[model samples]
Target: MDPWLSMYDFTYHLAQEIAEKIHERNRYLRNGENPVKINLSVRTLLKRLEESIGQLRDSLLRSVSTRQITQLEGDRRQTLIDELLTKERQLQMSFKGDGTEPDVIRSSLMSGGGAGPSPYNPWVLEEPEETRGLGIGDLKQQQQRMIREQDAGLDALSNIIARQKQMGYDIGNELDEHNEIIDDLTNLVENTDTKVRNQTRHVKLVDKKSGSCAMMVVIVLLLIAIVVVAVWPSN
Candidate 1:
């Protein structure tokens, strides 16, 4: 059953009782002049009551989440993961690419057999003039440039990729949790609504009885008037 609806039920009945009392008090007001103040303290009381309930609501919601998660087993979790992946893919696709190409220059420099040290395996620059016939000075300058480029490239890539990965994981978990929560809340709300409808039907039944009683009273008065008229006819 929905804890929220149960809580609301408690609160609603209290409000109804207070409203009935207020109505009864106003019914006896003399001359219908200078309306009685409804004791604004009622508002303060409700506010405090809401604050107290809010704490309970929070605790209950957490408990619901935990129960839902626990019920969610391997298949469910996997399904949730798949759903999350689909959403993540859609998000990735929605972002229009800025058309920036990969760092090809850095790629060539980092690859083996380049004039510079391998980025993945940085080593002292061997004199290339003796092998590939490229001047050592030119090779050294190129190596220095490649090294700087690789350093900058690595720094830029590290944070962006890491942050994106982290965000994907976080969003997936939250979505799964949120879905479970909605399911639980929906069930609870449906049950509460059923109860409210039942209560309303009961109220209507009472009103119908009251209306019938009022009609009977009216009919009796009319009969009395008819009897009085019939008896006065001789005068």
Candidate 2:
């Protein structure tokens, strides 16, 4: 299985677990549970989901360097990561009495909505029909949870963008390396061409000197022959 796809599949499983836990918690919260109790917060489940997402991101980054995955595949992996994030945010908004639509989590996870009263059913969740009265302390804790949710999501997004930038740098570095090799080859060719031209020029100069020496010897021999013939005829 593709690393990214496998990680994304696991995220859905985690999301299913969180949905069941939320249902169970809300079932209790409505029946005399303390309004101020945040000890049962699904915050832990959310962290697990985030870790799954982080692993997916890490997997994709590794594939880029080690497997040399294409840009298109990388982009699809990124889309899956973003989808998981969207699911997480929707899940966070899924408290009972929050007035959120039933499909908030279901539609994000699966196109087929959900099933039976079993909390184990994927995306099957239960929430209070109306907001429960909360003490000031509970309200504060809820506020803090929301803030933390936003920060965690942002941090995840920041890490993803940073990894993408790093990938870009890796591509650029490879291009620089190729360009350097090309440049070295070009210089080698030019240097070889210059040496060949110099050798040709030296050969031509040697030929010119040899021709001059031969012409001088022939001229001297002709002059000596003319003097001998003239002197014998005079004698």
Candidate 3:
């Protein structure tokens, strides 16, 4: 098999796989099943698909670099690339919402009602209600509901932040009060230490004066005793 043909087939099958996965996801949503599993599976599949597309693009570039494709083959390869791009667009539209209705409605709204379906997009002519399995009105309603949910989430987050801010302020005030109390206690301790030192000095001075007075009293008593002995010398 030609390398280009092999690459084309790979891309074509990968696109089909993505489309089928989209359908599966839609079915899960319709059934009101837990979307977590489906979402995880879809995400994994999409990653693989993107990697495969990159590989395909690189392979085409390598062929061109090697001058492997004839002029006719080059044109065919270009057509294949176009088809892959279309499929990729379709896959993206499917992921955005209930298939392509959102994109179609958006384009129509943007064009101011002057836009018609293009010949290249045959799927665009198909009734969106049928293809997407939902009316445009329903799609709009879903979008509005999603917006309301998002608004509610934002409000909740804002409330939480406000509460946290208030708590932070309260904590800061408490810390400041504690610091002030610590400073006051420190000053009180220093004043007490100074008073204690002054009292110790005063006590030591009083003790020295008492000792000097005792020595003077002893000297006076000795002089009186000597005088009495001299006056009684006749005995």
Q: How many residue pairs clash per model? A: 0, 0, 0
Q: Candidate 2: where are CA atoms >4 Å away?
A: 34-41, 65-67, 95-122, 126-235
Could you tell which candidate, 1 or 2, scores higher by lDDT?
Answer: 2
Model 3 agreement with the true structure over 170-189: per-residue lDDT tens digits: 99999999999999999999
Determine which window of 10 residues in candidate 3 has minimal summed lDDT.
Answer: 118-127
Q: Model 1, 158-230: lDDT tens per residue?
A: 9899999999999999999999999999999999999999999999999999999999999999999999998
User: How high a TM-score does candidate 1 get?
Assistant: 0.27
**Can you give the TM-score per candidate against the true fold?**
0.27, 0.39, 0.49
For model 1, what is the C-alpha lDDT against the true structure?
0.50
TM-score of 2: 0.39
Compared with the true structure, all predictions reach lDDT values of 0.50, 0.70, 0.69
Residue 80 lDDT, candidate 2, scale 0-100 = 69
Output the number of the lDDT-best candidate: 2
Off by over 4 Å in 3: 1-6, 9-132, 231-233
